[model samples]
Target chain A: DVKVTQSSRYLVKRTGEKVFLECVQDMDHENMFWYRQDPGLGLRLIYFSYDVKMKEKGDIPEGYSVSREKKERFSLILESASTNQTSMYLCASTLETGDNQPQHFGDGTRLSIL
Target chain B: SQKIEQNSEALNIQEGKTATLTCNYTNYSPAYLQWYRQDPGRGPVFLLLIRENEKEKRKERLKVTFDTTLKQSLFHITASQPADSATYLCALAPADAGNMLTFGGGTRLMVKP
Candidate 1:
């Protein structure tokens, strides 16, 4: 079975703080993604990395950035946390098998910005 | 202008009955449509995937149908148990190389005993 691990299950941060959410996958998948899920918004992609040091912006990438220094780890950075940034953050990884592969996901980190 | 839409209302059904969920999309062509199951406080889990060339796909008691003309997909669960209750999300992946996905607001399913 594939395992994707997020560093935190729940996190709280004050406004204007820098927050980091970490994710690691054991499957060594080449593609990793960061998404923020809000009520009525579903899962909107924030950023994705196809390979080490390679990143792409998704639908909603404002105020957020990503780092993929290694294959197993992907990190989501909140430049300046705001109350509007509070949402359930998810990390997913998948093999580079063209476009037919299913993404394996972590449990997610519920972020709260006060 | 691309959009993926799923029923936001929770679908309530009796146990041992079949439950169907709907997903619709517009303004974009996807090479693959995928369904995922997400419990409360957990990330979505991949359930099934259907390609644009295929009309239907099944796994165990779960079935999915895709219609490109209508830009809709239906997910069915036969003899559903309470354990089958969860939010189901549908995602559209374009025919391009990357795994870019556009997801819809998931619909929650509640199985009553």
Candidate 2:
């Protein structure tokens, strides 16, 4: 079975603080993604990495950046956390890019900005 | 802009009944559609996937149907139990897009015993 693990389950940060969310996958998947899920808004992609050190901005990438220095790890960074940035962050990994591959998700990290 | 929409209304059904959820899309043709189940405060779990060329796909009691003509998909859960209560999300990937998925808002289903 494929397993994706997030470094944190819950986090709290003050306004303008920096926040980092880490994710690691054991399946050696080539694609990794970060999304923020909100009620009524659904899951909005923040960033994605297709290979080591390669990144792409998604639909809602503002105020967020991602790092993929290695194949097994992906990190989401909030340069300056704000109250509006509080959300449940999810990390997912897929073996390849296509319709046939299914993404495996981590448990998610609920971030609170005050 | 490409968009996906699912029924926002909550569906309530008694045990042993079949629950159906609808997913509709506009402005883009998807290569495949997928269904996922999510519990409160948890990430979604993959349920099933149906290709544009295929009419339907099933896994045990869960079935999914995709209609390219209407750009719609239906997810059905047969013999639903209380354990089946959760939010169901539908996702679509365009043929030219690489692994990127646009997801609908999702439909909440409650199964009563």
Candidate 3:
């Protein structure tokens, strides 16, 4: 089975503080993504990396950034946490082969900015 | 702007009955569409994917149909059980996009025993 492990299940941070969310996938997929899911708004893509050290902005990338230092790990960073940034963050990875490949997701990190 | 929409916010059905969900999109040409199941507080899990050229696809009890002209996809679960109750999400991948997906708000299914 494909395993996508997230560093934390729940996290709390004060406003202006920096927050980091980590994700590691054992499937050796080449593509990784970060998304924030909220009530009624669904999952909005924050950022995605197609390969190591290469990242691209998604629909809502203004307040978030991502790092893919190695093929197996990806990290999401909040430059400065804010109340509006509190949401359930999800990390997913998929093979770069074709669009037909399904993305495997981590359990998710519920981050709260107070 | 391109948009994806699910037909309803919630659906209630009895066990053993078939559950059907609808997904629609506009202003974008998607090469393929996918369905996912998400329980509360958990990330969505991939369920099925149907390409634009494929009229229908199935996996065990789950079935999906895609219509490029109407830009709509229908997901059906046969003999749905209580365990099948969860929020179902539909995502679209446009041909122009490399691998990014656009997801709908999702419809929550409640199957009563």
Candidate 4:
């Protein structure tokens, strides 16, 4: 079975704090993604990496950045966390960069910015 | 602009019945559509995928139908049980090489016992 692990299941941070959310996948997938989910708004993509050191901006990438220094690790960085940034963060990966391939996701990190 | 709309925020159905969820998209064409199940406080789990070339796909009690002309996809769960209660999300992909997806808000299904 494919396992995508998020470093923190729950995190609390103050406004203007730099936040880093870590994720690792055991499957060694070529595609990795970061998404933030909120009520009524749905899951909005933040950033994605197809290869190490390569990143693409998703629909909502204004206050976020990503790093893929290694094949198994991907990190989402919030430059300065704000109250509005409080939401559920999810990480996902796929075996390949194909269209119909299902993505495996981590449990998620519930971030609360005070 | 590209957009995806789910049928509703929530749907309620009695156990042992069929639950139907709808996902509609506009201003874009997708090579395939996917359905995912997510429990409260958990990440979404892959359920089924249906391509444009295929009208329907099934996995046990779950079935998905895609209509490119209509730009719509329908997900159905047969003989649903209490355990089937969860939020279902639908996503659209342009082509195989591009895995970028536009996801709908999702429909939360609550199966009553």
Residue-by-residue lDDT tens digits, candidate 2, A36-61: 99989999999999999999999999
| DockQ for each numbered candidate | 0.82, 0.67, 0.71, 0.73
Give one digit per residue, the lDDT tens place, for model 1 in B1-113: 88888999999999999999999999989999999999999999999999999999999999999999999999999999999999999998988846777889999999999
Cα error, residue A60 of model 3, in Å, equals 0.6
Per-residue lDDT tens digits of candidate 3, residues B39-103? 99888999998888899999999999998988899999999999999999999997767678989
Off by over 4 Å in 1: none
Which of the two, 1 or 2, has more lDDT?
1
> In candidate 3, which residue ranges exceed 4 Å CA deviation?
none
Report the backbone clash tally of model 4. 0
DockQ of 4: 0.73
Per-candidate TM-scores read: 0.98, 0.97, 0.97, 0.97
After the best TM-score superposition of candidate 3, give how far the Cα of residue A27 lies from its true spot, in angstroms: 1.1
RMSD of each: 0.8, 1.0, 0.9, 1.2
The DockQ for candidate 2, computed on C-alphas, is: 0.67
Q: How big is the positional error of residue A37 in model 2, measured in Å on the Cα after superposition?
A: 0.3
Candidate 1 all-Cα RMSD: 0.8
TM-score attained by model 1: 0.98
- State the displacement of the C-alpha of residue B73, model 3, in Å, after optimal TM-score superposition: 0.5
Worst 10 residues of 4 chain A by lDDT: A94-103
